[model samples]
Target chain A: MINIGVDLGGTTIKMALINEEGKMIDKWVIATNTIDNGKHIASEISKSILKKIRQFGLETSSVHGVGVGAPGFINLDTGFIYQAVNIGWKDYPFKAELEQLLGLPVIVDNDANMAALGEMWLGAGQGTRNLICVTLGTGVGAGIICDGKILHGVSGMAGEIGHITVIPRDGAACNCGKTGCLETVSSATGIRRMALDALDYIDSESILRTMFETKGDITAEDVFDCAERQDPLSSTVTEKAAYYLGYALGALAVTVNPEKIVIGGGVSHAGDALVKPLKKYFRHFSLPKIADSCSIDLAKLGNDAGVFGAAWLCMQK
Target chain B: MINIGVDLGGTTIKMALINEEGKMIDKWVIATNTIDNGKHIASEISKSILKKIRQFGLETSSVHGVGVGAPGFINLDTGFIYQAVNIGWKDYPFKAELEQLLGLPVIVDNDANMAALGEMWLGAGQGTRNLICVTLGTGVGAGIICDGKILHGVSGMAGEIGHITVIPRDGAACNCGKTGCLETVSSATGIRRMALDALDYIDSESILRTMFETKGDITAEDVFDCAERQDPLSSTVTEKAAYYLGYALGALAVTVNPEKIVIGGGVSHAGDALVKPLKKYFRHFSLPKIADSCSIDLAKLGNDAGVFGAAWLCMQK
Candidate 1:
């Protein structure tokens, strides 16, 4: 069956037409108009989807349904968004509005959950019933899948991996109002912060200093690039981030016993630079048996995971 | 239908005839024959079950199946005990042996997992689909129930909460050959060790000093008893254990977002003394939304959770 997957983000809405085998039939992106608390989001998305359908000469009858992943606390059954601060939505009947406009069944879940399903369905964790996808973006997020489905806890607050305290003592403050969360150490932003903090080290030599002096600031990519070039200060920063990320992943592995952990988000582009030390520290912190059985890998699907996951959600219904 | 539930332990084997509604029809106990690597256990268990059947004048047809809760690394599907050191079993075909002798279908799972299912079925976590049961006995063990089924992970290693590190620095070692594990602080033995170590505190006014001077050693119960009588040192020890437990549970809440967290085993007997401090710390560490949604309570079935869980397992099939 053909289905439409919508990935609603703050900057853009990614919509994809996916077929029965999960291949993308076509894909489109539309600006997320945030004016007036996103009142026009449903109409915009519906129009875009219909436009794509007509262009492909596909009848509305050929479309099975739509699945949308939004950044919010959502009601899994009714697809209601309790709140998505970035999108300026609260108590929005997301599914009903879209269904009314499109005249089809729709399924909704949190964006992180959708990405995890996408990874499990056809990416790094492909064919694995039990998996965890950790996204190291500007901030950290995780999606836990067990028994071939997402784990949404009582309040859809499960997979808040970034908020878990790795430094249970005095650590850097996080935007979430907590101190020393995993997000404060391992996210792309966290790596950049750590790199900037290391600039005053007593005896350190690094290319990052020159990069910072020239560019005004260094990114997480600069740290990985410097580390690969044998830059001591940047290597130290990467090692510390890897240590915490591995430790948290180790804790999660035993908590849910996932078969594979797929690292995604923009920061995962560091690839082996992140996965190598990550595997080392994850094994160091995990139970010996679990550390042996669970595989940690990099995500392959990149930005398309959400759309794939959204489509997969519609197929489930 | 009537079925038999078995709780296998190092000291004895507890076998109970449980009805379809989970009521215990009759119970029997037999010494665990750990002689020669538990070679006689299967035959002994079958003989005892047959004797109980004759006592009730029940035919073989009346019993539908048998479910056993064993302590060890188990293959849930095959019911193979990889190794249960205390019971001296290794690579044992538990299901086949029991089914061959009793002429009935049999299922087996780790004891902790069974206790969790039992709690979900008839104890504190009754009817809750997403639940976590943390058992604080001689060691810490956990059972994770999500989506109304036990999460076995990929290798039956899920729910090893005890092994999760709480103290990331120099701390006490655990039986699992790890340091700073939650098991080193939250288990019954851990509490006893903490109380003993606290006795050397200068200017301490705890009655625990007198108890240890007279009795030579103190149990965790003595620590709680002393605290109830307003002993400062003992109270401090209990508080510390409660803090670590609460912190770990809070992290776990956001990981899987269970509807309830059931604290069981010997340490849980401290009741409100443990739950109160635990709740405070749990809320302190957990996301406000998750803390508000999930409930932390004591286990109701005590030791009987194993047998009830075993029977519940049989009913599921």
Candidate 2:
């Protein structure tokens, strides 16, 4: 069956046609025009999807359904998006609007959750029923899958791993109106902030300081790159970030005891430099038994994970 | 339908016969004979159950099945107890042995998980599909119920909340071979230890000192009683313990986001003295969104939670 997956993001909308075996048959990317509070998003997506279907010479009857991953709090039962900040959509009837235009079944889930499901289907999760997929990008986010189902707590707010308290006292302020969140120390943004903070220290001779002087700022990538090159200052900053992230994951390990933890998004590109220390601290904090049963791996699907996960959502319905 | 729930512990074997609505129709308690490596436990339970069934004038058909809660690292699918240190059992086929002796189907699960399920069915959980029930006794234990099913991650160690590290550095040693675990500061054993440690401080005037001198050692109950009577030392210990427990729950709120958190066991008897401070700290540490959606309540089932939870296990099958 042909399933259409849509990864609706702020800057771009990624769409793909996936087969029954979860292989991508066709794909498309279009600039997201969030004009008018994203009022036209549904119509634009449907139009683009329909045109692509015709060009591919696939009959309408062959199409299974559409699955979408969008940012924000959602009513899973009703497919309603509540305050998706990046897309500027609030309380929009996303599922109904998309279904009305497409004339097919549709499923909507959080973008992070979609990524986790995608990884579970054919990525780092390797078909594990219990998994935690964390995206450490500009900010940190996580999707929890238990017993092969996305766990959406009371208000669709479960798996907000980034906001878990790590510092407890005198923590960096977060956009989520909290301090000491994992996002404030482990996200790419947090990593960059820590690097900048560390560079400001007296006589800290490092390439990161030179990078800051040249580029006016250092990125999470710059910090990881310097650490890989054995820059002392950069290594300290990366280890600190990994420490908190690892500790948080350890706490989560005891709570849910996932079979696998898939690390994704930008900061994950740091590769072994990130995973090594993260794994060490993760082992240090978690029970030996739990740590032994669980494996940590880099997310393999990359950007396409969202779309793949979105498509995987269709199978659940 | 009728189900027999068995709560197998080190000192006692609490059993209950319950109707379809989860109400205990009859109950009995017997000594847990740990002699002979507890090899005769299954037969002991089966014979007691048969005698009770006959006394109640019930036919074999009326007893749908038997569900048992045993301490140990269990294989849920096989119902095998890997090692129950207190029960002196190792690699015992609990379900098979019980089924053979009783001539009825048997389901076995971790004792802690059963308590959580029992609370979910008829206690503090109040029928919430997603809930966390923690038992703060000699050591801390937790049972996680997600979407109305017990969550046993990988190897039946999903809800090991007691092991989550709270101190992270230079904390107290734990029986789990960890340093500074939540159990080190939050269990009944932990509370007594802290109260004793605090009483050792110079120039401290408290009834606890008088009690400890006379009674040889203070119980967890003495700490709460003293704290209730406005003893400064005891109040500090209770609040400190509550702080760690609350912080752990805050982190868990972001992971599974249970609708309700049920605090039970010996420490829960402290009532408002324990919960009031725990709720304040829980709210302080958790994201406002998650903290608002979740409520903390005392476990209503008390000692009977195990039997009720064990019975709930039968219904799941």
Candidate 3:
């Protein structure tokens, strides 16, 4: 039987028809109509699902169920969206509404959790049951898989690794109103901020300074490019970011002790330059037992991880 | 049917006959007798089990199995003692030996993990399926319970929260060869060290200073006593230790996000003097979503947690 997967994001809603083997049969994306306080989102998703079924000439009996990975604190038991700041959804009965509209079983969870599950099922963590999947984009987000299940804490706030107090004191302020979170040091935005901060002290020979002078703003990719070329200022910034990222992973290693830690998102594309130094700091911080056993690898599926994970959720049910 | 629960420690072995409901029917303690390369330890435990069975006039079929909570790293799947430093067991086939002696099933796990299970089964964590049980004795050890199961990582070393590097830079050296580990700041030894360090700058009129001046070496209990009376130096030391502990818990709250954090061991006996400050600092460090749901409380079962947890292990089998 085929499963329908919905990856609900702030900008777009990506849907896919996934087979039992976790391969996508067909996929489509629609603009996230967040207007009207997201009132039409459930109906819009339902219409898209119906159209996809009709277009594929598939019977409802062939479809297993619908699984959604939404952005926010999700109540797995009720499929209620407690809060999705960007989508303006609060205490919305998303799962029940969509189930009623489509007359099918619906499973919903946090988007990052879906990505983690997706990676675990079909990507870097293929054989691992215990894993941690971290996404480093605008902010750092993580989904913890312990013994092959998502660790949704008491309030569905488990895996808030981004907000763990990394700096301990006098660090960058986070959107969460916390200081010195891992997100403030390890994300793409954090890397650029670090590069911008270094510009004031960097010498004229630094490529990072030249990029900032010419473009007015340096991207995280530019910083990685400069570091790859052995630019001193950029190397320093990348090392610092990698250090914090690795340090946070080390902390997680001792806490959850996952078999594998999968790193994903835009910043992870820096590849070896990012992972090499991160491993160095990880070894320095983790206990010997954990350091020796847990392997860190890049997420292989990229953006498709969410839909794949969403489909996996349906399969689990 | 009854289960035999063994709480193995460096100094003594506490054995109990626990019923299906987890109540201790009969209990006894014996010297650990770790001499002669620890070869006789298992035999002694086997002898005690047989004697208990005969004395109670119980048939072998009436006993479920044996469960042991041993110190140091354990290979849960194989029941191999990787290394119990004090017990002098390294890569020993502990479960096979015990099972052969008693002709019954045997299960073994880390002492801390067992305590966590015990607490969840019948103590402070009785109602919570997801919990973190932290023991703050000479060292800080934690057992992470997720969905009613102990989170044994790839190497069965998942709950080593003690070794999580809390002090990023130059902190106290830990026995694990790490600097600034949570154990260095949150454990009983750490609390005493913090109190001793405070002696250098503590005012002459402070009761902690007077205690230190008279006693030469103050105990953790003495520090707590002084703090209870509002002694400045003791209060400062407790607050510092509590801050580090709460900070570490805050990190755990986001990572594991257990339903409840049950604090046990020697230092936790300080009661409100410890938990109140810890909760305050935890709030300061955790995201409001996590801080609001996770409750930190003292462990209820105390020393009995290990035996109870061991019995619970047998019940699982």
Candidate 4:
């Protein structure tokens, strides 16, 4: 059977046509314009997905189901994206609209959750019944899978680990209008901000400053590169970010106690440069038993995780 | 059919014979001594349970299974209590020992988780599939239930909400060797500490001072009583404690997204004194959609929640 998986992001709509074994036969990426109406966007997604399926020489009737992964609060049972800040969506029935447009059943879920599901089926988390995936990029995203099932909480927001309060009283300003949220201290943005803060505290000439001076923006990636070269400032900033991130994961381990944690996204590309330090600090903070049960690894699927996870979802039923 | 449910605590072991519909047919409590060997204690429990069954005119063979709710890190699948701080237990297989003594199938789980499970099945959280039960006594205990099943993470250490870090960095000393845990700021002990802090910061002729001066120890109950009588110091302390507790719950809500949070134990007896203020602050700190999906209420089963939840566990498969 062929399943169509769509990953809807703020900037692009990526779709894949996959076989029963989760092998993507064909895929396409289209630039998404957020200014379009919800129905129009849904129609566009349908067209792109159909085009991809035809390009792959797959019959429409052969398609079992279509799954879409969105970046926000999505009610998995209801197939509604309650809210997606990046896309200006609020309680939009993307699944129903897309089903109408394509004349096929559609399943919708939070993108981060789908990514974790993808990893569980075909990436770093394969063969594990319990795992958590953390995506460290422009923003922090997390997905928790337990007992071979993705846990969709009462509001389908069971895996919002980024907002878990790591900083109790005060630390940094989070976009959620709260001070010292975990995202504020441990996300890619947080890591870059840490470098800027360290620059203010200590005068240092390094690769990060060069990037900021030239590109007008410094990312967590530039800091990782600098840290790899043994730059003290970048290393200190990245270490601090990893420390808090690990602490948050450690505390979360006490709460959720997953067997493995798969770290993904742009920042996770730094690999052990970030993970080794994170593992050290996570053990330092969590209870011995909980810390011992959890192991961290980088996500193996890269960009294909969305397609893999969304396909994995349809395959579950 | 009858099912024996036991709640094992430091000072006492409470047992009940629950009918299929969850009615308590017979109940008893016995003193539990830490000095007693685990095997002997298991024998005693089995004997007492048998005595109760005979007295209630129920045949021993009619009893389907035995369920035990214990404190500390437990292996639910293995029925082993790895650690119970209050009971001084370590790697004790109470289930296997008791099964040998009574010749009946036995199941064991974390006491707090069982309490939350009990509430989910028959108490305040009845009819709700996704619920979080928080027991706010000397320490904070939490049980997270999703999709009608207790989320017993990979290591059976899931739902240890008390140990989740609430403070951004570091604040007070916690029993878990970590500073600024949620229990440190939200439990009964936390309220007492906050009350003391308020007394030092605010200058006033307060009932709390008189009560504390007259009584050697200041209690959360005393502070609540003082606040009821319009003591400024007590109110400030309650507000401060409520604010942080609500903030932590709000952050937790974003991640867990439970449909309802059932609060129990000693401090929860304050009812609206805690819930009202907590709701106010939860709204201030929670992600908008998460806050909307969750409702905070008092747990109904009280001390019996453990046994009931354990009994419910028996009926599961």
Instruction: Indicate which candidate wins on TM-score.
Output: 2
Under the 3 Å rule for N, CA and C atoms, how many clashes does model 2 have? 0
User: Chain A TM-scores, one per candidate?
Assistant: 0.98, 0.99, 0.98, 0.95
The residue ranges of model 4 lying beyond 4 angstroms of the native Cα positions read: A20-22, A33-35, A38-63, A83-92, A100-104, A167-173, A194-204, B33-35, B60-62, B168-170, B193-205
lDDT of 4 at A78: 76
TM-score versus the correct structure, for each prediction: 0.97, 0.99, 0.97, 0.91
Predicted candidate 1 versus true structure: per-residue lDDT over B159-227, tens digit per residue: 999988898888798888878889999898999988877886556656989999899999998888888
Tens digits of per-residue lDDT for model 4, B113-174: 88998998899999899998988999987888988888898888887777776674657888
lDDT of 3 by residue, A1-317 (tens): 99999999999999999999987999999999999889899999999999999999999899999999998888889999888988989989999999999988999998889999999999999999999999999999999998889988777888889998889889999999999999999999999998888887665578878888798889999999999999988899999999999888898899888889999999999888899999999989999878888899999999999999999999999
lDDT of 2 by residue, A45-153 (tens): 9999999989999887898899999888899889999889888899899999999998888999999999999999989997689999999998898999888888888
Clashes of each: 0, 0, 0, 4
- Native contact fraction, candidates in order: 0.75, 0.73, 0.81, 0.70
> How much is the lDDT of residue B238 in candidate 1?
91
User: Model 3 interface RMSD, in angstroms?
Assistant: 1.0
Task: Give the DockQ of candidate 3.
Answer: 0.81
Pairs of colliding residues, candidate 3: none
What are the runs in model 3 whose C-alpha is more than 4 Å off?
A: A201-205, B201-205
Provide DockQ values for all models, in the order shown.
Answer: 0.78, 0.80, 0.81, 0.59
lDDT by residue (tens digit), candidate 4, A11-111? 88888888888787888898876775444688788888777767767787888888888887777877888788788888798788889889878888889
